[model samples]
Target: MRLLSRPLPAALTIGLVAELLFCWRLTTPHMLVFDEVHYVPAARMLRDLAGPVNIEHPLLGKTLIALGMLIFGDGPLGWRALSTVAATGVVVGVHAMLWQIFRRVRTANIGAVLALLNFTVFIQARIAMLDGFMAAFVVGGLAMLLWAMRSEGGAVWRRWLGGAVLLGLAIGTKWTALPYLGMAGAAFLLVRRRHPDLWPGLPALAGLALLGGAAAATYFATFWPAFLYADQPLTLARLLPFQIDMYHQQTQVLPPHTYQSNWWTWPFDWRPVWYLYEPADGAQRGILMLGNPVVMWGGLVAVIACLIAWARGRDARAGGIALLWIASVAMWALIPKSLGFYYYYYLSSIWLALVIAAAFDHWRDRLRYWDEAFLAASAVLFIHFYPILSAAALRGPQSFHGWMWLKSWI
Candidate 1:
């Protein structure tokens, strides 16, 4: 355990475990689940150079999936392998960011553990989707930003450059990462106010402007693949029009579906998407995107406690977690997508998991091992729900109800 007293080693260990879980029976269902039908084909088109497919999303995610196919062959493994790695990258990035913020290996380990157990990241990783890549780059960018805040002149520039690139990649993977720009700007201003002398050589406003410019340049660069499409490949003049089309597609009115949930209900786990359910792999199986009860329910209380600690007790760690959780979740309210799903809260769920870690870290004096205790409870739920969560064989079709406490889950 003493070996994990450092950040890098602990992050490696946690990431290894996460990768194993994500890769376990990775092709179990052997068919597309949920959005994979849309994305996986697009990936194949990219892989074969057939043409543009699923143009509503940006190219980076599909490019990664196509690259995975090139390396792993066009099968379930290829469709999802890159996403699995990307999702595991999020776990490592969260650990790195936690260490930067909390500077405590134990707290960072707790954050990584919660991330591994969190329901949303796990499911997204095992599927072929854009969100996994976007989430990874988003967390990595934030981690780099934290490092940049504490570094010296040249180091600060290098890290900020890295962060800006990652931010661009995040947005390139999915437009959903745009709100993080606002979040990062607000965070930088607050951090500058708190640590006035840290970025000694750079003016705060100038630094923000530089980061934004670098991020935009990098974002525009991500569209080069669009020019490779055979039919009417985009030119410089058409990029803006292409973006306009994508925007309208994203914001266009669409009919409602059963699994769709409002942004407000996402945090509460009011609706869970059944990614897979039916006979498959020789037995009854299911894969439900339900949030863990302990993390989702307990996390709400932890967030309030962390907010109180930030407001009244002047705890910066609690404040950082609270700020990030809000930034990640709150933007969905403003998104024009009428067809929002529970997975839209994927980024916020990671921060809520961190809130649980930060809250226990703050109250360690009286709480003692309460963090470990609750994590144990959450881990038990992880196991209890493993059959459905991991596509493990069930006793029968009715087995899905064994873990379904609410009718809404159906």
Candidate 2:
């Protein structure tokens, strides 16, 4: 219990720092950038007139964006304010999740710092996107699941039900979040088997039903806005067709994008997607949604090390992180689509950070200050990539060229 509560300040501190980093000069690119063009207007329509827009995705994220716009008067900062808040929650959630699973304050703190140093987390936090909201909810759900696993029978359902609600919200934000729900279900069954006393008379099937039912109910509730705003009367017959249309729209192939890289290329940082690039006379700006190489590549290595630890010594923490990373990565690979972006690796990257943290916890006893050194190096890399990550104007073409490690990144 102390371990759970002790990290509250650490989580808040990480979140506060992330908000500052993300919110600094938040209105620089005064207009819509990248996917903001798609979702922000939808948000505006929703907030202004309760109209349906971007029906392919769920409404909660856009609703949050709409709420921000309504409260803040629809500036660049207004559009992104909720994203910034969600990103901060993600940082805080990562700290809580890591501490819950690993029970090491230093390891948890390191994972949270690693998250801030991660370019995708930092950049996605600043932009108006569903991915940030999904990431925050995913982390929060995972943390809640861990808390449930640690609880007695009396509190287990409440904790697990809370986790299910968050995961459902995650799914409502993006369908990609569905895999995490599956993972949570499997984990719940495991907890039931291993800790039968914790479940009392509840069977695993009944427990899973309760969890999944809660998630399904929450997801169905998130569609209320769409139902209310549709031209036709609200009915399952009407909604089913719209859902089918959305699915078809998503899966259909489109023209090639310059930064469209496969899931395999993400961990390698092969091609960084340029979300925004402007070459105006006095206002050259760019935002490349790529992971920091030091952290990304190093996280890949940590995944391997964690796998080795799991294979050789049956390290549960190591194994859990490695399995989670593999599952997250594999989920993208299994997506039956011709197009995917580097940011598709966002969920996997969070698990990789956990792998790095678990390995750090192991190595801290044997190798002194290596964890600290890694964090320091990661911070330096974040600084080096800030210009491109934050869309800051370059002094010249050469200033931009200096940061491009590969021609694909250009």
Candidate 3:
């Protein structure tokens, strides 16, 4: 009973299990999933040091995918290996960050299980996609930030610098994480408000500026390979124009897509993206991106609870998570993009787990094992949907008939 409440042990166990689940049948179907169609080729091009490809997004994610291809020989395994690792890092990072914030084992454990089974991160990691890497590094950056802000007596600056490096990697992976660079500084100030002895004063302004510079430097530095491999020669002068080009591509309108969904629908899991549903290697395989219903739906209550707690008691920890939950989705609404997709909510899905963890942490004495109940429901949904989520074999092409409960999903 006591062991069940220890954070580190559960974190380690959940991290290990998450890695094992992510690794299982990872190379199945032997085909690229959805955006993998775009990113995988770009990764290969980056690996071969050939012409530019998939330039709409930053190069760091594809570069990491390219590194996997370089090491693993540009096959199914190579394309997805690091993505899986990054997703696993997300799982561990979520658990650890929850512990750092709430200092509760049940909260962290529930959050980890919810993250792994949420189906969003699980499928994202299993494919060669930028979201997994972006989510992983941002979570790492935030976790390190929590540590850096709380730590004392030397090495605090080192921790902050480490967090800055990871935040740079996250933004370099995708502009989706760019907002978090600013949000993390805000988190530092919030943490200081909770405990004044830490940073003590208005040093946050200077710290925030330093963090921005460090993260920005690290972000721009990722463009180094482009000079050698891009479609055109890239100079310091050319890079800014190149980024402007990317922003344009990202905002360009396209024909309506079947899987496209709005930002608000994401929290409800109203529409699911079917990344794969083809007969492959003699078995009908399908992969779906859907959030865990328990977490998706339950998180609404947790988020409200967090806001109420913050309003009444100025519970900065819960308030920070509530703000993060809002910011993750609200940022997408503010982005210049003309279209949106369910996968865009992957970051919000992670925040949902965090909010749930915080809510339970806030109500630990009153709520009792509600955390266990939520984790159980999430795990059940994960297993029930495992076949579709993992590209597991189905009887026929019509296999989606059972999984597509909503017309929107169909």
The C-alpha lDDT values of all candidates are 0.86, 0.82, 0.85
Writing each residue's lDDT as its tens digit, candidate 1 over 97-144 gives 888888899988988899899888888889988989999999999999
> Any runs in candidate 1 off by more than 4 Å, and if so which?
none
Better of 2 and 3 by TM-score: 3
The residue pairs in collision within model 3 are none
Clashing pairs in 1: none
lDDT per residue for candidate 3 within 243-333, as digits (tens), equals: 9999989899989988888888888889888898888889998888888788889999999999998999788789889999998888887
* Pairwise lDDT winner, candidates 1 and 2: 1
Best by TM-score: 1
Better of 1 and 3 by TM-score: 1
Question: Candidate 2 has what TM-score?
Answer: 0.94
Which ten-residue region of model 2 has the weakest summed lDDT? 226-235
Q: lDDT at 320 for candidate 1? A: 81
Instruction: State how far residue 252 of model 1 sits from its true place (Å).
Output: 0.9
For lDDT, the strongest prediction is 1
What is the RMSD, in Å, between candidate 2 and the native fold over all Cα? 2.5
Structural similarity to truth (TM-score) of each candidate: 0.97, 0.94, 0.95
